[model samples]
Every structure is written in structure tokens, then in C-alpha cells.
Target: MCSRLRWTISSDSLRGLLLACLLATCGDVVAADPAAVGAIAVVVRNDSSIRLMTRDEVYAMFVLDRRGDFHPLDLPESDPTRAAFYMRLAQKNLTMMRALRSKLVFTGAGRPPQQLDMPALIGRLAADHTAVAYLPASDLPAGTRSVAVLQPSP
Candidate 1:
């Protein structure tokens, strides 16, 4: 005895099936929220005069597009939170940021911000009244105050 099965799947149905299979195999990766992976909090020393900042101000400071007494610090490019910060605040990825900075440097427009590890960044923030940096929201230091919280785009 032989049996045959015939079926048709609409384009939407096929797409849904493919999506389900992809999710099944890569759910942990795809299902994870980019914003939830790491939210960034822009901070300054507690005693500093700076109180509030808009997102544009933060982005300008970070990208060296604005010249002010403010000193912008940054985490190393390899740090995951760094990527999250730029993406959330400026809608930029690491490559785009690097390219923009390079162009600025090449044209003598501005220099890239200083890169530091978490401890070093904390120390700088505490020591330099003009310093501003983004830290993982979950780990903000005691002597620092958040100026803005850059949440990832939905």
C-alpha cells in the first residue's frame, strides 16, 4: 500500500513556518531584547554644576560635535554597553561612530573621546568635575549622578 499527502501553504503561512523554525533554533539570540541587554545612563560627578541634559547634547558631547568645557569619556569599543549607548542615544552603531570620528580627526574637526574601562571611567568621573560618561544603569557609582538615561529604540 502507498499513501500520498498533498498540501498547500500560502506565502504568509510559509513565512510563519520559516519564522517559527528560525526562532526555535535561535530563540535565545533573537528573543533577547537589545535594550534589556544593556541600558546606558549618562553620568557626571555628583558635585558638578551640570544638572540636566538633552539627548542631543549628550550625543554631541560624545561624538565631539560640540565644544564645551565638558569632557566626554567613553568605554572601550569592545564593551557591549558602549554599542548600546551609541545606538540608543544617537542611533549609531560602532562602525558608523568610528567612521564619523575618523572623518572628524582626518579633517581636524575633533578628536575621539577618551576610552576607559569601568573602574577607570568611574575614577575619572569622580575626579574630573567636567567629565561625563555613560555607565551601565545597573552599576552607577555612588559619587555620580545620572543626567540622562538613553533607552534603546523599540
Candidate 2:
């Protein structure tokens, strides 16, 4: 009887552990989906003196159709946040943007923005007053300030 009782308790404990693990994994999956969240913010160094920009202005800046006093910094193409930012703000996918930039560079008409990963982007923004980049709202570092809040398109 005691052995049967021990086996039953062990089974219940194992079930509880499995349930806990499943719940934890689900939470991580939801958090990993950027689309499940709200919009990202376009930011510059805290000490940057640039004014807030409108959607069109930001689009032009990203596409190299216009120039601004501040240098533009881009997230690496493979970054999920970079994909979201371009889709929401620039109205272009990464492939389209890269093709356009390549054509411009080939013609000597424009140069592409400097590309960096999250940590490097944040560090550069903190040190370079002329640099601007977009990051997820949650990822914005303390030394940066949002110049524009980019909403996702309908």
C-alpha cells in the first residue's frame, strides 16, 4: 500500500512539473513574437538636437531620397525589429530597401545607412550625437530619446 501511494505522488509531481514547463515555454513564445506588441520608436542620442520628424520625412531619410543633418543608423537586415521598423515606417521590406540602396550606391547617387546590431547600435547612439536609429520601445537605452513614435500601418 505504501509503495502504491508513493508511486501515485510521484506521478502527480511529474505531471505538475510538465505543466509548469509548458506554461513557461508558452510565455517565451508570446514574448518572442514582435507583432504581438505595439509600435517601435525612432530614436537618437539624448544629446542630439534634431527635431521630431513626420512619417514622410522618416521614409525619405531611410530610402536615401533626402538628407538630414543627423546620420542615419540602420539595424541589421536579419533583425526582427529591423523588419518591423521598415514595414511599419518605411513601407518597404528588407529586400526592396536593399535593392534600392544598391542601385543608389552603384550610381553614386547615395550611400546606405550604417548597419549594426542592437547593442552596437545603442552604444553608437549614446556616443554619437549625430546618429539616429529605430529600436523596439522596450529596447531603447537610457542614453537615447525618441524622435518619433512609428505606428504600425493598418
Write down the lDDT of every candidate, Cα atoms only.
Answer: 0.76, 0.73
Writing each residue's lDDT as its tens digit, candidate 1 over 1-154 gives 2357655331122455767786766543323334664567889999888898898888778876584888788776657788778778777776898788878878978777767778888889989999989887778899999999976565
Candidate 2 — worst ten consecutive residues by lDDT sum? 6-15
Misplaced by over 4 Å in model 1 are 1-36
lDDT of 2 by residue, 72-131 (tens): 878765567777787777667667876877787789787777777788888888889988
Q: How much is the lDDT of residue 82 in candidate 1?
A: 80
